[model samples]
Target: MSDADTARRALALLDLTDLADVATADGARDLCRRAVSGPVPVAAVCLWPRFVAVARQALGDSPVRIATVVNFPEGDTPIAPAIRETEEALEAGADEIDFVLPWRAVLAGQLTTAGAMIRNVKMRCGDKLLKVILESGEYPDLDKVRVASELAIAAGADFIKTSTGKTARSASIPAARAMLGVIGMTARPIGLKPSGGIRTLADAKSYLALADAMMGPDWATPATFRFGASGLYTALIEEIGGAAPGAPPRGSY
Candidate 1:
């Protein structure tokens, strides 16, 4: 594909994220400002729960959605806090909830906890989107990653995500391949998000190509696929148009 085609695809599916530890109200406002101010608009902005309202207010009347993380990068929170966090984020105006799947429990062979946690959040999520973060890197092997993907989907995850962008290992082709395999087999309309360490146009294209190869060219869209990154929008804007002077700085979730 040409740079234009790739850039278009990347920009349309991008989730402008700002989950940094030092994130302030001003920074959240700035992130929202940049999302709408960009050359091409992104699908959503993923923020911490506290900033969901800030983002919602900053993005008033815009088509851009607001997403927030729960159980976040650790994936080890108890079920109560996790569900409460999801509820609070939704009440705070998050359009979507990205809940970590408690992979540590899955790693210990406790599949029931993983399923119950997702089901609990999904119940509260109602019609709102729920993307389960598999934290694929924490799994010992690709097979484990695939199992986690399946568990999340069966438990009612609208999307299965790769990483939290806070791990020693974030998104990888092999891990994403495993998750995509699960997504392709499921009869339900589950999405895929390959996040973390994906900060370049080339990085975004690699995952987009993988999705196209596995799920057909037109399958990945704003609804079915997303790149969760804080720095990638800059590169995409530069590639799609020219310089991106207003692009926000890189951060994590």
Candidate 2:
């Protein structure tokens, strides 16, 4: 595909994010505005749970969905608190819940603990989309990545995300391949989200191309795939030949 075509495709699949520690209501509003101002609307505006209502009001009936994080950056939040966070975010109008899976539990061979958290949070999510952050980069290898992916899927994650972007490493192609391989084997529909450090159209194309290769060319609709990014939106807009909006402060994806 041409750069313009790739940009448009990535734009539609983007989860325009603002998880910065310093994020404010004004910042959330600006993110919402950018989400809809582009050539095509992003799939969602991902923000801190506190700003879900702010984003909802800013978007005001726009087709763009609202996404918020829980147990974010760090996945160690206990199940009870995570559930409460999910409940609160849902009540505040979030359309999707991106929960950071307790990957440390997975690494410690406590798969049951990780799985329980996903299952409990998913129960609260109900019909809402639940994207579990595997924090794949923290795993020792791709094999561990696949293990976490399977656990998340079996535990009822609608999507398995690559990272929280808070660690020394974030999304990587090997980690993504492992996650996608697991997703492909499932009879149930599950999605993949490659977040963090994906800041260019070329970066977006690499993942899109990989998805097409592994899952078939028609597999990556917004519901099935997403690029969790902030800086990437500007690169996509530039590729689409428009004056890009002011880039927002960088945030961990």
Task: Please report the candidate that would top TM-score against the real structure.
Answer: 2
lDDT of 2 by residue, 6-82 (tens): 89999999999998888889888999989999999999999999999998889998999999999987999988989
Which residue pairs show collisions in model 1?
none
lDDT, candidates in the order shown? 0.89, 0.92
lDDT of 1 by residue, 213-251 (tens): 999999999999999997888888888786765656546
Task: Give stretches of model 2 more than 4 Å off.
Answer: none
Q: Give the C-alpha lDDT of model 1.
A: 0.89
Q: TM-score, each model?
A: 0.97, 0.98
**What TM-score does candidate 2 get on C-alpha atoms?**
0.98
Best by lDDT: 2
Least accurate stretch of 10 residues (summed lDDT) in model 1? 244-253
